[model samples]
Target: MSSTQLRANDPQIPSSADGSQGLPLLVLGALGVVYGDIGTSPLYAFREALHAAGSPSVSFARLEVLGLLSLIVWALTMVVTIKYVSFVLKADNKGEGGTLSLTALARESFRGRPVWILVLGVIGASLFIGDAIITPAISVLSAVEGLEVVAPTLAEWVVTITVAIILALFLVQRFGTERVASIFGPITALWFLALGVSGLVHIVEQPSVLAAVNPYYGVRFLVVHAEIAIPVLGAVFLAVTGAEALYVDLGHFGRKPIVVAWFAIVFPCLLLNYFGQGAYVLTNPVSEHPFFEMQADWTQLPMVILATAATVIASQAVISGAYSLIRQAMHLNLLPRFHVRHTSETQSGQIYMPQINTLLLICVVVLIISFRSSSALSAAYGIAVTGEMLITAALLFVVMRRIWQWSLLFALLVIIPLAIIDVGFFVANVAKFAHGGWVPVVIALSAAFLMQTWMAGRRLLISKTRADEIPLRTVIESLTKKQPLTVPGTAVFLTSDVEGAPTALLHSLKHYKVLHEKNVILSVVTSSSPFVADNDKIFYESFTPHFSRVIITFGYMETPNVPRALVLAKKLGWKFDIMSTSFFLSRRTLIPAAKGGMPFWQDRIFVALAQNASSATDYFRLPTGRVVELGIQTTI
Candidate 1:
């Protein structure tokens, strides 16, 4: 089987045919994409923890530096290395990985209906969107804040420069990640190298910082300084903020490349830098930006410029991840269909969504303006990152117990400690509710509501439509017995239920009083896997001499193009002609009812979402001129 057809939930790790040949390149690409978010954390993560450690009684000293460094080191080891790389990465859905992808897998594996699992998936995806906005704002702001260190006089231009950089980053997304991907690997490689070198320089001066690797300082600090541990965790969680991205981008780089990249280069560099910062902090107790201060005076300006570039690249990973996530949401019926434009001809996953891009840009810009500084934005960051991680750990337990067929004891044994750790971080971040933490919580709740409403609204629409729907067999038999005025061309009515008469077909018969010479009831299904084989793409069932039910299957990661897929109909003796085909669609105008299943406000939200959703004609790549949409009002 081709690599794309490999199931993500498959027990074994997939090996690419060219895996050995391109091992180095794949590792490089993985570094650029998978590691971008966590890689850039060194810019502000250590600094933020320092700020968080500031209590009235606490002072910047060797103990504090060692304790914070230990916390960061262990956080990375537990969160990224052990939890994600070793465990969560193993849970894939047909070679695909992400919150929604794994959610679908676990949901399917459950013996009975598991609605709560769906809620978990939506919340994970929503908080990811929250992370999407904040990563760019905080990353760019922190990177640009280096200017304050380079030239104290340029401090006032920081926000403006940050905004300009963010705008440019979002503007170029249309060209796709492929266009800018080549430079990402080398730049990030150099960034990590610089991180190690700079930290190495300071560690030589105060080699005692190396002792933080023992993890004893980390545990001791939390125990001894129990009073401020909560706030400290919120900042310490920053060390592994982008750890989920490792699992989210699993499809792009595969399991081996990502895991290999993390241990071999990414993990070690991050450790060195965090420890180096600890060493620097011990000497310069009152330093504002210790990361920049760790470098030599002459290299400070160049490091600032490099950091800015790295932050932009970091933002790209989050943006592209959001696109992948929303596309999955749409496929699984949790969201309205949006236009997904393929930017690279060679790679199917290299897609861009204009609506998501614009929305994210606006949110990021507003955040930069509102917070005006990275330190302020930092208060909003940990909540989403930790919340998403907690959700992932929850889903991981489900995958183990249900999908992986592990015993309950085995599952609990694995997840309990991870849960305790995740819950600790989540609780710590939650304490920041008054300090901008509500920003992400609010965004997550809003997004989860929209997803739930969309799914519920679609179910209601389908249920209501089925009330009046006739079996296609009955329609075909009736048409054969009493032939209506037959037209020359073919008519294709798209419907969700292939067995039932399409609403558009029923409407067409009542108004036009005619049937086409050839009629096809078409239903397109999204499979759970990432790609479907061509041989199994189309399934055809002929109901009568001139009537047929056609079903086309597309993997969640693949686009559904009707004209291209319909070409396969010729194999079943159905001559296909796009010019002679007339596509029929049913557009429902949903009206909120006082006694509907959902809340009245949610019903209204569903109505608005359905109204603005992309049309079936454009989504299915139907010929615009030959398409007709029949509108129907439904009270639900």
Candidate 2:
């Protein structure tokens, strides 16, 4: 299909054709994708920060406890509310929000902005991807670790179960998660309710702990012993780690729904839990289950099960996010061409990419075997999150100047505080470099290398092939002496553009110089976000003087249903039943062609990505028997 048509703002969104149910599903599903990581952060944030402060006795009299709460609330206000909600949410490009999206905006607008800024933005986004890998690992382990409390001896068993659960989730991705997603929102909603309930019970028991919210406690705690505070701040920032996920995933749910959901349910529950954890710690001298200690002993099983399910759901959200990010990478020419399978027909946001799933599964397993506990993963988590925050800061600067036309003073006021706070987390996490942070660094480095290589290779391929990409009009005038003969059926060419490629037409002529049985239809398929509109459809009346051309677009949310698209195209005038007509693809297999143009290294990389790209038949969803391949050699 066409890419231009699927933009989220397309009128197709509220169309009578889609029915009224799609919007609500999209709103909830988007919330899951966006909040999964942040939602699960509560599992360790307060606990780790508390544990780091020398496991201070649970009491309102203890200044460390009050300081910890103050740090938690302020960090959330700065990193999550101020930076992400107020600033990053406004830094969007066509409803698409991400580090890369921001980078593009910056590069396009502030072309000469300091090179270091761009570098930081890339590093940030790349690291976020790495964080994505570890999120699944740590979140799952944190939840399943509960088994130890259930049966201390079952710790090993818990690991096995956690691994198995993760494996099953990845394996079933190809089958699609549309049906499962229908309930994810409701289930996640319930999980938040449980967390709130647990927090409420503690709040009622010890009302005085609420005083920790006062800013004075945080200030005194930090200055009293700033040395220890440095490391403690490391854990404090963890509370707000996934805050950016909310901004990046804004496209999934419109701003209104996400804002509504956050204020109505998500935000309150999170605060209560943070306060509740503080209350529980303040009351209990010995908390075997600091979190479960916040709840009654009889309620253990329910919390355990809810926590387990919630964590798994959270991990799954990152897994899906990795898939979506990679898909976007492919579209933007920063990744090798991989098979992208549409997991849902009705819900465009649902997608399953195999390469990404396998990577997540492998990395998560490795993370568990190496770090072994939620505490260890803690060292790895903040680095990626912090790095991503810096990248988002740079991106927001661009959006302010370019899109919003805000003055530099205004932009700096918004971004500087973010840089300061995130820089602290970054430095603290650097101390953890040798601990468990290496995994995320390794993943980020790998992703960055892959992206650079793919981009370098594409630049070479596109540049080399530019001269050879024969104009469509030129192809028709030079080759076709008579008008294209109309026949019993339409013959569609899998064209790169609706018009172009003398080689394609020449091949068509070489195979059958004169049309004998089918009308010629040149079709161009475009890429757009999974959930967008379709409006740029066009049928050319005069191209190459002999052949007719047509363009069709598909939202990334929609699968390349060739037959379905053909039916729609036919209704618009080009008649071809995909089930009967053959689909053709031009594949260039690069051999070390010594020296037409591209750099030597580029030639090799091109060969690599070309070799790695999905087979056209499967990528295009063509019936194997009915598909045809044209092995064409490019000058490069």
What's model 1's TM-score? 0.94
Could you tally the backbone clashes for each prediction? 7, 15
Assess the local accuracy of residue 270 in candidate 1 as a C-alpha lDDT between 0 and 100: 92
lDDT score of residue 478 within candidate 2: 54
Cα lDDT for residue 581, candidate 1: 89
**Candidate 1, which segments miss by more than 4 Å at Cα?**
1-21, 55-59
Tell me the lDDT of model 1 at 390.
Answer: 87
Compute the lDDT of residue 542 as modeled in candidate 2.
30
lDDT per residue, candidate 2, 545-630, as tens digits?
23455555654434455554445454444455666676656677667467745567766766777787887677656778776678
Error of 1 at 306 (Å): 0.9
Worst 10 residues of 1 by lDDT: 1-10
Q: Pick by TM-score: which candidate is best?
A: 1
Q: What are the candidates' C-alpha RMSDs? A: 4.2, 4.7
